[model samples]
Target: MLAAMAATEQQNRTWSQIDVPDQSGRVVVITGANTGIGYHTAAVLAYSGAHVVLAVRNLEKGNEALSRIVAAAGHGAREVHVTLQALDLTSLDSVRAAADALRNAYSGIDLLINNAGVMLTPKQVTADGFELQFGTNHLGHFALTGLLLDRLLPVRGSRVVTVSSLGHRMRAGIHFDDLQWERRYDRAAAYGQSKLANLLFTYELQRRLAAADASTIAAAAHPGGSNTELMRNLPAIVRPVATLLGPVLFQSAAMGALPTLRAATDPAVEGGQYYGPDGFMEQRGHPKLVRSSAQSHDEDLQRRLWTVSEELTGVRFGV
Candidate 1:
């Protein structure tokens, strides 16, 4: 029995650096690819010979990231094609425009990584007048994915990988009545809701894709407490504590990106799967398949969220 258990554990194991396959001929679009986990993901994919489009809000930062990725690629850089495209997730118009630009430039996208997000920010509304976190983290990606559905559907093995967070476990639920949080707002709770929405979106998208019999899939991942810019929005008090604990408690950005890369590229990965770190509490380690909260798997909630997201974004998926 012990031997059998050990075998099972080995079969259901975490993915490592050697597990990543060559990505030649693949076109990957990663949002917020200018920094942190996004940048690391883009760098690795580019090095593996994929055409990586860094969909970022800031063109200068995106170009800078591209340059750094190229420099890191060394002689392999010749085969890597990294381009920058402006994408501001806070605005519906910007999301639509960016999707349109991508559709015009690329015939198909093999991977779409929704990796950009804000964390624990003070109460604010997006240009669309929705809560900042929900609007950008969930609604924005929903719109972009819907707009790019045409490009993704026709391509074999296409995928949409949304990045959620461990924070999703904390007091997180869809606030349908106050989706915008116009009444009472707690920064942490708002961030949690947005992350939970990411998972809900991913699961619903996968269901729709399967129903449509499309070759594409949807998946979700989390960075698992890495030292990244996403923490810049944390409360002032928490920021200093995080800084002091950074070295010992947090993993590097590159390590944090593994789960996302695995979700996007792993051949054995199934639709609706969530990836995170293999370490204690999923804080830091190599990438592995991880279980989300019970709420994340609620089908009724997923459908409701999907409908509301469609209404807000004004973009409907073909799936």
Candidate 2:
């Protein structure tokens, strides 16, 4: 019984709590920064003095977020510069183009936040014919991360933070042969698979970085239950259920971002750590370390996924 309790406690403290000093000279790229938790994260980072690049799908929405950030920053707005860049995760071409533009503009990226994702979205195909959720949430970020890895590695203390979710636990596992679900499609199942992939990628990338003796750190975070636009596509039937119990089960967007913010800025954070809210059901609260399933740490699946992603995107990341 004591051993069981100790094991549980150890899992809970995977990421230490420590203050992250100012990020005056840091450059950060965040996806889906137009609204919800993404916007709050960008705003907070900008307020804290990081040069934030908002990688949004809609230019107009991106501009709005920039304005909001500027307004929120007040006189210190000069310390935080928000650059709006177009990034449609569903399109490989768009991802490649945005990466190119970012590389041309910034010599090194201190942080890359793979935050943009769709949740419980309707079954649809992306521009490259991949499932929408998998395309945007997993493959898109994979390609972008690989593309920007060189710039990231050059920086002395760079980090790539990938946002995942508790939905991952619902996934059976990655269906490697039929990743796109050509034969069938289940919205929640697909979303869960993608979230699980995010964790696997985070762990696998950390391993790869260790092997290459790189200075960069790779980590993952889940917002708990932040009630973001991620659930916009949930079937109408589910919204009523969510509304009836959302307050009891979900946290505000600002609170939802704490785990992510912690992962990005915490000085004590190391590669492969995962963070989430420390609440009764992980539905909301302060940032704390979290545990993922044994499947998420599988080395074989990570390698296979990385290889397949490069082939599908036609853009190698190590470049």
Candidate 3:
């Protein structure tokens, strides 16, 4: 159980406060870039000069987000890198189509942000008949990452940043036997499994890259308690409590995106590390390196999940 990362060097920075480094030649693909934390993440990165491909499910939303980013960038004498592409994470075919489109369009990808996800919501199946949260949040990204890993490998120092949540601490880890929640479907548990998978995927991916002698880094980050569209499916009663607690405990979307921005842009980070807010409960504040749950680092489950994911998606990740 050795540490995967070296000494921690957490930071305290906001999106606007971030130092913009030259990213003109780099390309990044972010899922769920049309709204919420994903929107802010993409906008900030694009505004800083990284050509951003927004992999989203809805073209209308993606175009709208692109327009906003473009318009916003016009004011500061900065030309933001931005583009919109269709990606429905609920379907394996859709995931492949998006990856193929990116591979065909770009020579190398500097960053891949597995940012799209679903929260605690009703039980539904994706196009492939898997549970909705698990499918869209974890499996979809797994397939997409595997499919595009070759393109990523060629770009030395490339990184894959997966967005997870503090809810991961709640469920503890994956329920391998009932991962799909066949017997009983607790929405929160399902979401927790998906989030935990994000961490596991990050670590397992790093292990694979090392085994293949690749330098690509895989890291994870969480937004804390940001006001994002992730709460769209929560019970109506949950809003008032959240609203009341938000001002004191939650952060703005821009603030919430800091950790992700840092993980994406910071040169000091290492593979298999995680970042989140540094405030009380690690719920809201500036970006900082943080710890993940014990289950997140379970090697056995990680390998099993990797095999299952490859078999299910028929995609093999490359070095």
The TM-score between candidate 3 and the true structure equals: 0.94
Off-target runs (Cα >4 Å) in candidate 2 are 1-20, 76-78
Query: By summed lDDT, which 10 consecutive residues of candidate 3 come out lowest?
Result: 1-10
Shift of residue 276 alpha carbon in model 2, Å: 0.3
Off by over 4 Å in 1: 1-14, 76-78
Cα lDDT of model 2 by residue, 1-319, tens digit: 9977865664456332234458788999999999998998888888777999999999998998899889877773456778999999999999999999999999999999999999887779999999998999999999999999989999987999999999888855898879998888988889889999999888889998988889899999999988888767878988899999999888889888878888899876789999998888788788888888888888898888878877888877563
Models 1 onward score TM values of: 0.95, 0.92, 0.94
Q: Give each model's whole-structure lDDT.
A: 0.92, 0.87, 0.86
RMSD of each: 2.6, 4.0, 3.2
Give, for candidate 2, the lowest lDDT window spanning 10 residues: 11-20
Over all chains combined, what TM-score does candidate 1 have?
A: 0.95
Question: What value does the lDDT take at residue 157 in candidate 1?
Answer: 97
Choose 1 or 2, whichever is better by TM-score.
Answer: 1
Error of 3 at 36 (Å): 0.9
